[model samples]
Target chain A: MNPVKVILTLIPFIWTIGMIPFVNRVKPIVFGLPFLAFWLIAGIFVAFICIKCLYHIDSKNNQDS
Target chain B: MSSESMALAIIFVFVIGITIVGMVPGMNKKMSLEEWAVGGRNFGRWLNWFILAGEIYTAFAFLGASGWAYARGGPTFYILGYGALAYLVGYYVLPAFAPLGRKYGLMTQPDLVEHIYKSRTLGILTAVIGVAFLLPYLQLQLTGLGLIIETCSYGQISRVQAMLMAFSMVAVFVYTSGLKGVATTAVIKDVVMIVAVVFFGLYLPIHYFGSVGGMFEAVEAAKPGFLALPGGTKALDVGWVMSTLVLTSLGFYMWPHFAANSFSAKSADVLRHNAVYLPLYQICLVFPMLIGFTALLVLVPALKTPDMAFMAIVQQTFPGWALGLVGGAGALACMIPAADLLLSTSMLFSRNVYGKTIGKNTSSESMGKIARVMVLVLTTIALLLAIYLPNMLVNLLLTGYSGVTQFFPMLVLGVFWKKATKLGAFCGVLIGEILVFGLILGKMDPVPFLGQHLNAGFVALVINMVVFVAISAMTYKPESNKG
Candidate 1:
């Protein structure tokens, strides 16, 4: 496994759940959502993009997928 | 003539229509045990996507989500994290499972455990736990269906009658169409469910509260911190959120049905490819929470059953036809997955229990037949529970969820760690499950030392990992029995 691919995969774990303790707030609402709600929703897209990039690379590096 | 009749009529149409949709494939061809239990292992993109979604989303998505958001506040966001994280984990893990499965014809989770440990007893133990987890889930579906129909039909049909009629049809379709039927109905269920869920999820906030932001702003103003974690209950804070997220994400794919789905993939590539897009579904979850938050201010006197928040608001506000659509979608959400769970759980009995014990020499055909019979027997039990004890599933759900997480160490370590042994795996499971159950049953969850910061199950998982690693090291001998 590429070290970068491994990091990219783990990013969501930190970004999604890791960021939770710090982002547990009601203010600084982004685009009408509470900051906490906004961050979690954004986390979903972050996960999708991260996985998409991983899939692109893995497909090229290994045919075994 | 009446609103109740219009809604009820539309729901009945959907129930029959989905059954027919599911039944057509199995009408002429006799679906093999292999086809229904493990799938044909040749699912395309749509079917793969449908299979995961079918297994994942259910009435819990609608009622339970919205209710918690409506009643509790911030902790509901935890729901969004677990699925995305589960997929993230699946991206790497499932591809591993695919090839291992094909080589061994691993049709069930117990089969995997059996293969990994070279122990039929551990396999039987897994089958027992797998069924234990599934029964609560199946009960949740039946009760969720009953609630949706009873509320949407304006109480014209009692919850008991709705569950009886609707779930019997679900069982019939499962009996006839098997896995292909579940897949076919899943495609349709998702389409209707998406449209209805999105519409209400968006419409409720916009129509009542002016905009989504306005809804949150109003809710936060009325109840400060309600927009953040621990907003609903004191027991749930950031630590609880963090710990629960750990427990659930690690444990999510450990469900036996997920194992079945992973094993049946045509290629490791298929499994990896699907993982990429599945996270997108997590975005839809935000809608239900939005509806629940919107209901918090709008509903006077609040709701008696927090789960009724989604349906109650829709029933009060929408037209009959719209309510019918949501009800129909909700029923499908419940039924399709419930059908899959029922079939899979029984096969656990027929394959793992019966195959290993009573009739070790039985043919695959006869095993499949026994599994089919098991579906009806299990459904009858679930239906009886749904009618007599609606709240039991909710109570068991807490322990049941944590109980499944204990399997994580066994599955992940067994796959990656060559040194892992059968004795280690078995002992770890036995001890972990006992400790987890003891803590939960003793009401020491959120665990005393950890306080309310960590989830009780995560504590168990940590211990499980320790024992698994420690025992495996002691038991390790140079390239002994691979099983």
Candidate 2:
């Protein structure tokens, strides 16, 4: 595996672990959303982006193969 | 009808409709035995993610996590804490299992273990333990469903009647759809649960306490320990937290439905993607615990069973329509896990025990038939257990965690280590079971070395690893099966 690919894979894992402690500390506002709402909505957004990235990589691998 | 009874009747009818609709896809498809048992090994990334999440976050997550948070306070955070770490760990571990699952056409954990060990006796042993462990877990899911019905119906519906109603729906769908039923219903359940969590997580605090911050502040003032880590009590110290995290994280994948879903993933990458994306599902839980904590703040002292906290809060805080929606979501949360467990238990009996041992040459149609029969049998057993001898939801779930984690050494290590011998695996498993049962029987109370409650799982894992390594070192190497 490429080192860059490995690091990219680690991003969500690291981000999630970091979020645990930060869960208690978030200031309760994001564009009118409460802190928990804002954080969860943001998580859904990140998940969407990650899914797209994974799809592209998988499709690219399929085309190359 | 009274308001609560009317609401419950509507929810039951809705759930039954969902289960029937979910069974349609599997009924239409003519699946071979392997496909029925393992989803034909063709699930895409998204389907696998939904199914895996549905399986892992069970009635336990809905009821047990909040209940623990309600009763034990900060100690219950270990549920999410361990689950997050488990996802990261699965990113590495599941890939190894994926390729092997694909290679052997394995349908259950026992198939994978037996393939590695080349021993039918070993296979049967693993199957027996897996079935034993899974039964209580399945019963716990049924018990959760029973609680929901009993609560919503205001005890008009007996627990036995409720379990039969719930488990029978699960049995019908699982018997018809197999893994397809589990996957299909999981998608619906996941969407419902996610929406419900988002709504309740945000709405309850604002509606009841003015804000999430206000809710937390009130809880902090009343039960200050609920907000702190490791809980405020000496019983839930830092050591207990660390031990629980380790034990549960290891136990996560040992779940039968997890193994079944792992087998169903199209590729290793799909499983890895699931591990990466799955934590997002935990977001649903954050609010449920808040709901439980809010109940602590708002409710009278006598109404304190953690199992009833969320329901009590909903009854007190919400209007009729909103309460119905919460009831529906909680019902789905409990039902989805119940359905998954029923399907997985059926697969274990048919594929691992019957197909591999009793009827080695069973045809695909016959195997599928046997699976359906086993689903009925297991559902009956779980319903009976739930009706007569139901346990406290949280402790019952913990007992399952301890039992399932006992398989970790064999399943996890067997895949990566070519040097893992059958004898070593057997010894490791034997000693692990001994320690687990011994601890359960009070042999290691006060924890021989550690002054903590000493999770039987952690002790069993230590013994398992030591025996596995020592026995493997002394035994001659087995011939490589791979070309």
Candidate 3:
């Protein structure tokens, strides 16, 4: 398995499931949004970036193979 | 003309224009089942983007997401959350299956199962299961179309009339144009939907609550706990949300249409490129959820049918033309997914079940003809079901996720592990479906395991894994390596 692929997949897990407890709170609003709402919006971006990195790694792997 | 008449006119014009867009691709051309079913395996990045978006973000994304937000609050986040997670899973899972699709001329997800397990019966079984789960989903699109049209017409057209009109047109275009038609219409649907979503998502918040933050603040004050996990609904809790997110995301691409659509990409890298950008669409979903939240806070005495929440808000807040545009977008959103589902279910039935068994040795032309007929047949069934056996949008989709997720273990194990036997795959699917359906029929709480009260679908998955591994261990033979 490509290390990059493994690492990238884990990003969604951490951002979504892992941060649920801490970010699940209603207080400590970030950017006018509750923490949970902000968490989801930000988690999507994080997942997007991870996928972007995976694309780069995958392209390189495709070239090598 | 009254504002309602003008809105209706705009919607009618948009619908007529897009119906033409849907048919133009395969117009005046001879297409075999191959071309009709998989777009001749020639989808480039942009085309793939449109098709994927069309398939993934349906009326469910627009209406259902917001509806859940308006009615239930925080659990609505799971929609986009699972979407992003699904794309992440796709980044690895889908690309792995792409090679097999191209190599074997695979046109459907069941075709992939047949190839991997070398079992025609299993392929047919997979097709049956696909149809079962997919009916409610396809029904969802048609139901959404009916809702959009009825709402736009301001009760000028009835729901049954709207569904019959929309679905018959969709059936014709899908029959004539095939996947190409769905793909083309998807391009239009997605553009219109993005504009509508962004407009409502942003405008509603700021217009009503001053800023997006201000909307959250209002909800937090008036309806406390509406912004947090498990929010205002007793039906959901943090564990349910967390487990559902994990399960749905993991099972995301297992939807038969999604798996088959993977074959539409030009190559694995095209799919990879799509995964990277697809989440941007999901991010835009935040706006719809915001719209839902705004509606919850602003619209007094909450809506009876929350599915109407988004459109009701549009009617209340926006002018006639804006409402028309939003309605047009919603209608197209409904049609795009409906077309894909119609094509997929028809193709699977014709190719996997009928062609392999009763109509063996049939020519590709004959198969294409049969597939078209099946498209009409399946459309009527879905339309009838949509009108007669109505359901909440998010509930229908969640039920679909449960059914389709049964495919996850088989596909994942089949690709990564050579030792996963055919018996294991079969037993796993059977047991998973039985457990899930049993739990549903019996009205039992999903067994508590792993510190979460897992849904029947996920619980069944764990047991299915156990059954698969145990059965495969017993049945293994060196001759099985022939697979």
Candidate 1 Cα errors over 4 Å, as ranges: A63-65, B389-395, B448-452
* Cα shift from native, residue B134, model 1 (Å): 0.8
On residues B56-157, what C-alpha lDDT tens digit does candidate 3 reach at each position?
668878888889989888878777688888888888888888888889889899999999888899999999889777777788778778888888888787
lDDT (Cα, tens digit) per residue for candidate 2, span B132-231 = 7778877877777778767766677777787777678878887777787778888888777777767776777788789877877666667644555445
Q: Please identify model 3 stretches exceeding 4 Å from their true place.
A: B388-398, B445-452
What TM-score does each of the candidates earn? 0.97, 0.86, 0.96
List, for all models, the DockQ compared with the true complex. 0.83, 0.13, 0.78
Instruction: Report the lDDT tens digits of candidate 1 across residue range B1-483.
Output: 677788988999998899899888789887788787767777777788898877666888878889999888899989988888889888888888878788988888999889887889999999998888789889988988988888778788888999999888888888887777888888998888788879999999999988998888899889999889889787788888888989998898888888887776778888889999998887888888888988889988888889888887887788887788778888888998898888788888889988999899999888878888888988999998877877777646768778888998898899888888888898788888888878887887776454556788988888988999999999998668632
Error of 3 at B343 (Å): 0.1
Q: How are the candidates ranked when ordered by DockQ, highest leading?
A: 1, 3, 2
> What overall lDDT goes with each candidate model?
0.85, 0.71, 0.83
* Candidate 1: residue B328 Cα off by (Å): 1.4
Distance from true position, residue B404, model 2, in Å?
A: 1.5
Kindly give the stretch of ten consecutive residues in candidate 1 chain B with the minimal lDDT sum.
Answer: B445-454
Q: Kindly indicate the candidate among 1 and 3 with the higher lDDT.
A: 1
Q: Chain A TM-score for model 2, please?
A: 0.67
